[model samples]
Target: MAMNLPSQRGRGRKAPMADINVTPLVDVMLVLLIIFMVTAPLLTAGVPVNLPDSLAKPLDQDQKPVQLSIDDQGRLFLENEEVAETDLPQRLERITAIQAGGTPPQVFLRADRQLDYGRVMAVMGELNRAGLNRVALVTVEGTPK
Candidate 1:
């Protein structure tokens, strides 16, 4: 007399997994967040200069402003790259020429606190000649008296 026994193959088979795996995705997202957090401060730390203190509010910008820095020695830097006084106008033209008839890009002029007013004005004059009229003098936030 043979006793009926269930096949072992059917018992070993399991249903396919239907749930999504999110551990890897969460790990990737966390890595990206950390990378951005680390590099965000570095992006804004361009051309270090002692900026003058002002009690003015920051401007609301629709686009990234061009960074024009004047060091204490009156050296000029365009977007953190050194540019000759004579070459500034041409560079500015090239930047604006990319967008035909569109409003000129805003320029954030960062001058050292010790920079002479005349030197700053001269750079501003150059900016004006290059048709870059939307210029904002960048300054540090000052404590109220």
Candidate 2:
């Protein structure tokens, strides 16, 4: 007597898998990427100043440096904290002392495009008097006229 084996014609296709599905995960990741791209530009914190355009390349800024902002109205800010011109040197000295060892960190200066040349120079003079010698002017790359 011959025994009957299952025929291949009975199973035309393989059974569906019960594995994990990543479509939802991929969709969530894409949404997150788009959200980050939209909000990243607006997250920068600083006193708003229309910076003068330059053709210079951006610096290799990894560490957090002291920031100075000179607005169109000639108002001054040190790392988001407003400081008077008469007392800026004192504040800077205190900050330098806080750093303690090693050379003082460089200052990133952002001045408005409409600010007077003299005012910017005056701030530099005061910065020099405060022993903050390394100053880097921050400007955006200009577009063609």
The lDDT of each candidate is 0.88, 0.85
**In model 2, which regions exceed 4 Å deviation?**
1-18, 143-145
- lDDT string, candidate 1, 1-145, tens digits: 9965555777856556689999999999999999999999899957988898899999999998899998888888999998998888899889888755888899999999898899999999988988889999998899633
Kindly list the per-residue Cα lDDT of model 2 for residues 19-137, writing each as its tens digit: 99999999999999999999998877568988888888888865688999999999999988788888788888987787668778889999998988999999998879778898999
As a whole number from 0 to 100, the lDDT of residue 101 in candidate 2 is 86
lDDT of candidate 1? Answer: 0.88
Least accurate 10 contiguous residues by lDDT in model 1:
4-13
Q: Candidate 2, which ten residues in sequence have the lowest lDDT sum? A: 7-16
TM-score of each candidate structure, all chains considered together: 0.78, 0.77
Model 1 regions lying over 4 Å from their true place = 1-9, 15-21
* Candidate 2: C-alpha lDDT: 0.85
**C-alpha displacement of 66 in model 1, angstroms?**
1.8
